[model samples]
Target: MVHLRNRKNNYSGILIAISLVIMITVVSLVFKQIFLNRNNENEQNSVLYIQLLNKAMPVINGINYNDEVDTEENISIKGQLLKLIGIDIRNPFSVIGKEISMFTIGTEDSSENNKVVKRTLFKINPFDVNDKQINKSGQDTGDTENLELPNRNVKVNDPKLKEKLDNSKPQVLIYHTHTTESYSPYANYNTSHKKNVCSVGDSLAYNLETEYGISTIHDTTLHNAIFINSYHRSRVTVNKYLKKYKDFKLIIDIHRDGMPSGNVSALKERTTMKMNGENVAKMMFVLPKKNPHLSKNLAVSKKLEKISNKLFPGFCRGIDLHFNFGSVYFNQDLSNNALLIEVGSQYNSVKEADNTGKYLARIIAEYLHSKK
Candidate 1:
């Protein structure tokens, strides 16, 4: 009887020990799964933060984030949770949250961020008369000019080619393809003619008529409703004017440039520049390589670039001959003197762009008065 009782006690102790081991193993697995899930959530949150940052960077200028300063404490998981809950301690009126409802965080349209692959045929040196050849790989074949302005006087030696200026008729037609392409302080698709690129066109037309004594037609047509076919819509507008008027010497399509996603450094460099003791947006002349009237259009671009740089050094970012991408003609095939001008980037203010418009009017007036 004593041996049987001792055997039962031993079996009971063994069973208790086996049950403890099984409980411990199950607990460990639960903890491991919880830890893994947390890690995955953290990774997804980080990715979401980056995407949000990219969208916000262009709208909010002069905000820089140092990678080294992004410690776990500075950008904690708790902080991310706070952001998700609509509280950003860093910025009181942060665009990240729903509190600032005026600005849309996402792109207005998919075409706004569409990737355009292009090849440069040539890049004109505004300061130099010589044309620089760009390889098919879009690299300069010759020594590139230093963009820094040097202390030198540039005089416009007008060409002997002459055309009669008809004061009774409009000589220039200025329009916007991406009409809603707006600027800083309020960056987004805005329909108000007072706020968007239409305002710049208005300024240009006013300056051309009032200051330069040049007849101009500024078309305030909105064509970016379907952004993918913006050029096509603007082309119809241009054709209407062409059919009505026979005296149109120059056809200009004005647009604001956009910086690549998350490239704030480029935004600073490309958009704004100082001209005549005031800050103004820089201008770039875009010429289509595939246009039927390439030579005439190229001539117009080169002439304007030269004139602009001569007047305001470093104001013109130089002529870019784009090939095999974007609007192949940019409506330049419709007219020899047609040009697609990018006045400023999305970061430039309407005031800055208007300043550029005033200067652009002067440039165009000079170009028009000169002998071809």
Candidate 2:
């Protein structure tokens, strides 16, 4: 009887071990598929994989997972996973593959490379300011004559407009959808507000208030911490502001452009332009084609582009219509005045971007002052 009981217990133990092995094998296969399949159409899968790994790592390593205390351990697990998948997190290109690259090669903006479909109304030769004028098809016209810009002093004669401007109410709301996008002399992304798009937003807000007398609000919320559904997170922030403040005239989502991995040199050449004998980062206006307020937004962008070309030629890279076939609204439907502005590419220096912020503030001020 004793021998039979021991045999039964041994069979039960063996079955339990086999079950555990099968479960682990299934989990490993899932992880491998999630990480190796680069063409996965579901963008949220990566985030889900990370979250699952974060929870699973503790159990696999036999460590207690306390959410607050296991932060470093979670990061260590992520690093290990990256290594297991033959990915070097330090390489910007490798990181770009894991996350979406802004305006990168083979991305939605791939049309920028094909001159036939390039939507740039005018492409300014940064090397020669006088060579401004590229037609709709992206050909240089080489027109040396400068285009006359609207007068900056052309203000509306409405007393109500003047009062609104003078009331110290915020007229512009500047936020960053990809808040961690950094510039040249650093990696592609950073958490430091001083080194990222937040710095540009700061410069813009400061210039708007002190130099142009335009009250501005700069929201430095970190929305891209997870790198997925970032627009959704930022949309909540935008809605909070819209509900709280009624005076915001312009909603600007600022971002730094990104090029394909190993193409920093071309990015620099494309995004850097000479202005006032100094290198200033070029700016681009990106509009979602499906926005409900497309006409009003396009009008605002056109006005800004004209003002930029007149005052600071070549600083504005012509407006880009994006996501025409998709559902990326970019929160522009909430307000007709919403604008997504890419200040510069990842290779531009912080100073160059700051220079752009100052000029952008001036352009915006001119627009607000001229509006009825």
Which one wins on TM-score?
2
Worst 10 residues of 2 by lDDT: 64-73
Writing each residue's lDDT as its tens digit, candidate 2 over 1-372 gives 999999999999999999999889767856665665533212334444655665767655432222211211123344545655656564445555445423222212234442213121222222432224633563423221122222233221223322323535678899998788887666677788888899999999887777766777899999877556577788899999898886378999998876544334444656767655556788999886767789998999999999888777767888888456122477788788998899887677888788787778778877887785
RMSD in order of candidates: 19.0, 13.7
Query: How well does each candidate superpose onto the true structure, as a TM-score?
Result: 0.56, 0.60
Query: What is candidate 2's TM-score against the reference?
Result: 0.60
lDDT string, candidate 1, 263-308, tens digits: 3433444566665555677888887666778898888889888988
TM-score of 1: 0.56
Question: Candidate 2, which segments miss by more than 4 Å at Cα?
Answer: 1-168, 325-328
